[model samples]
Target chain A: MIRIDQLIKRYGALMAINGIDLHVPAGELFAYLGPNGAGKTTTIRILTGLTKLSSGRAALNGHDIEKETLAAKRQCGLVPQNINLDSELTVSENLDIHGRLFCMKPVARKAKINELLTYVDLHERSKSLVKQLSGGMKRRVMVARALMHSPRILFLDEPTVGLDPNIRRRIWSLIKKIQQDGTTIFLTTHYIEEAEFLADRVAFLDKGRIVAMDSPIKLIAGLGNWAIDWLTDDGMQTAYFPSRTAARESATAKENGFTLRRVNLEDAFLSLTGKKVQ
Target chain B: MMHGIIAVYLREMLILKRRLKRQLSGMAISPLLYLIAFGYAMGDAVQFNGHTYLEFLIPGLVAMGSMTQSFSIASDINVARFYWCIFEEFQAAPISNFAYVTGEVLSGMTRALLAIIVILALGLPFGVVLYYGPLFWLAAILNSFVFASLAVALAMLVKSHADQSLLTNFVITPMAFLGGTFFPVDRLPMWAQKILFLLPLTHASKAIRAVALSEIPDWRAYLVLPVTGVLIFIFALRSVKHARD
Candidate 1:
């Protein structure tokens, strides 16, 4: 569980994270959707205690991140946005160090490392050096390393950023399995489909503010069931319709080529903020 | 806190163990060259303070080697910070700033101790045996502590890995050459001696060389090393906190 109240983070003249509030109940997979520099990473950084908050309060489970830093940090595991695994270290060694940092007992650390390696489908590659592994494998190792402490919550910041579609799907399944196993996941990503497919609830953050927050299906439903996309002189445009027949009729009225598709989480975000998630 | 320190130290030791062969060679090369070039070239031809030039140079080389090796921890820290992003993993973990700093400082000291061992072993072939008493080791450790702590503090402050190199060039290099490592600080002009005396390495060189040469070591040199080490250690802790900000 996580709680944030009127959280504001300012970097000199720039408002990296404007006033925002959020609460994620235990075992919920919450996706924070935003474009580049939308304060998604900033919010995650604040919550993880990597960066100090300029104002307001944030707590992990019940521990205040500022006042109870070690306790709050112990409550959550973060898979950072980048591939930060130690390249020179083996997969098992990396996980072993994380366990030690969290003060896990040697036997418990070894057992957890074994369990997580299997959980992430990396047991076979546990002896491999991180640098020797492929991108997807490295990402899996990072996931396993983060989970070594058995933290109550996991903060995944763009976990599948550079992976191919197939690998992304695999990571998505792993994420789904994690949520099913009762770990609360706080994910920040720019990929609309990732949020739609994996998150139990979604928050669309724009310019350091949350413009929309709801379940993916409900957010998409708010924009209707069907979407008609067509290229115009200005740029690409889209319109939503409650029925496929209505969407087809709208597409037929367009002179240029058009696409008729189901309304997705992106349409909802665009409709609310007038900006693309990418 | 102890667990955090051990965890951090263990990571460094693991890496060091993995690269022990190459690191051993690296630790040997510079001192080997100094011994052959300066030690053999001036073997018994020169004497300083009632000892052969080789005898004088071995302890000086030990002091310089320990200082350089201890300070080299910064480069490793910078690499973890910039390339590997391993430092961020520590930042996100439950480890306190004090624990992190202490762990890194100990690792640096470990490297320094290893380098000292290599230098002492290298000295054996030349029949250059000297006193390696507890006091000698205390001076060595205190000297390593000062530089290693300084290294951690500077590692946090530098913006890039390149900046870390610049710091070595400006800070460590000068201290290595002028800190009574090559010759007696007393032999230098009064003004130069005064300035070099300000260097912790200079006191370390004096204390270590005195003990190795079977003389009564100056108590002042022992006092300076730990006092400077503690101050730099506090600076390192504050730097880690500032880095998080």
Candidate 2:
């Protein structure tokens, strides 16, 4: 569904996205994870044809975004981070105008707006002015706005930020449903758990570089902690470890018993980046 | 291109409509307030070519409205586009470069023309003659579009809303006032009037004043519309195309 090769973006002497190569297969939920200023947003902008890539190639279904931009963009929907919307316009009108932009016929446009509103659970609020709605409602409306054209792929840049946990979970569920309906979702998020739970494949970007790319479980198990936690009867129990060979022969093994448990993404993240998760 | 252009334009108008109570009031009243202050108050004191001061000032005010209102389009859009980030949504969509630029200019022109009409309507009772009514209106539309196109060109080159605001106040207002809108260019020295004629607003004001005063107007008035329109259109297209990848 997406291909990026040796993409490089530079501002004067600073590199925003450097030599990044990526492939997102059709119908896959791909999560792009990166720290702040890691060029994830820049990459998203470039792919959407909003910003120019300094050098390299990006194609959507083999249509180059730079050459056949309109056709390329027609294949993708982008939900931006800032929740850009027409606050004065009613929900229906906003969707209506966006649908019109896609050259959808009036009758079809009305039906599509209804379908999208229902898909986003915003049918009841369609008559209300966008400003009158809550923040989470506005975000959902934006999601519906992106889906108006029914693009084969959806790109969300930080879909959940500044929203409460409940809203975040709701959005996550909706995203899962979208993927199930066979739309490819490419998202960039700061929330590691979001990537962990939703992404079929995760790409870790740090400082304009992709450091790690793998499945969550394999990523965690590959870099093991093998932890066991228990409340000892005496409460002063110690833990033991083996480096190699019959390390149990050490006196530490005889002195204490430790439980073993599987390591998770946080462990792998810490191991790979050496930065503790907040 | 047309669909996307009009979609964004209609979308912007919808936003304005949502804030209708405020948008309608703000745009409608500012010109009337000017008419009352400059028209009624000074109509008794000022005289130009021996006409009522209100009548003389009304045309200038109309011209001023066109130029200043054009800036308002760019200014408000700059706020929504850069500060509020509404423009990025258009960027991320399938909207073409021409459509995006045209949509923006159209929104500005629409608002500017509406303001001018409201001002004209409000002045109808105050001996605001519409001699050559259609001609005057046609000229006003042409001039409004010219200023709007110029504004879009400037807006494309701007980096921030604050910078655009500073330039608008410093550049747009002075050009409107000195473009022979306030008084006749004949009042200026020979060299100064010649300099003023070089400005598109001068011809714009001439067209308005000629129609308002029931005069025939100079040939320059006829040329200003199409020439200025083409120049601004060409320059704006080049700017937008250069910025587009």
> What's the TM for model 1?
0.99
Residues B1-245 of candidate 1: C-alpha lDDT, one tens digit per residue: 99999999999999999999999999999999999998888878889867888899999999999999999999999999988888999999999899999999999999999999999999999998799898999999999999999999999999999999999999999999999888888988999988988999999999999999988899998889999999999999999999986
- lDDT by residue for model 1 (A99-210), tens: 9999999999889988999999889988988889999999888888888888899999999998999999999999999889889999999998899899999999999999
List where candidate 2 sits over 4 angstroms from the true fold: A225-262, A276-278, B241-245
Candidate 2 predicts chain B with a TM-score of 0.90
Clashes of 1: 0
Q: State the displacement of the C-alpha of residue A100, model 2, in Å, after optimal TM-score superposition.
A: 1.8
Residues forming the 10-long window of minimal summed lDDT in candidate 1 chain B: B41-50
Error of 2 at A272 (Å): 2.3
lDDT of 2 by residue, A1-278 (tens): 99999999998899999899999999999988877888988999999988899999999988898899988988898899997887777899988887877777898899999998999999999999888999899989998988888889899999998899999999999999999999999999888788889999888887788888888877775654353334556663322233322233332354356444445565566667866433
| lDDT for position A189 in model 2 | 89
Docking quality category of candidate 2 according to DockQ thresholds = medium
Best model number under lDDT: 1
RMSD of 2: 4.4
**lDDT for residue A36 in candidate 1, whole number 0-100:** 98
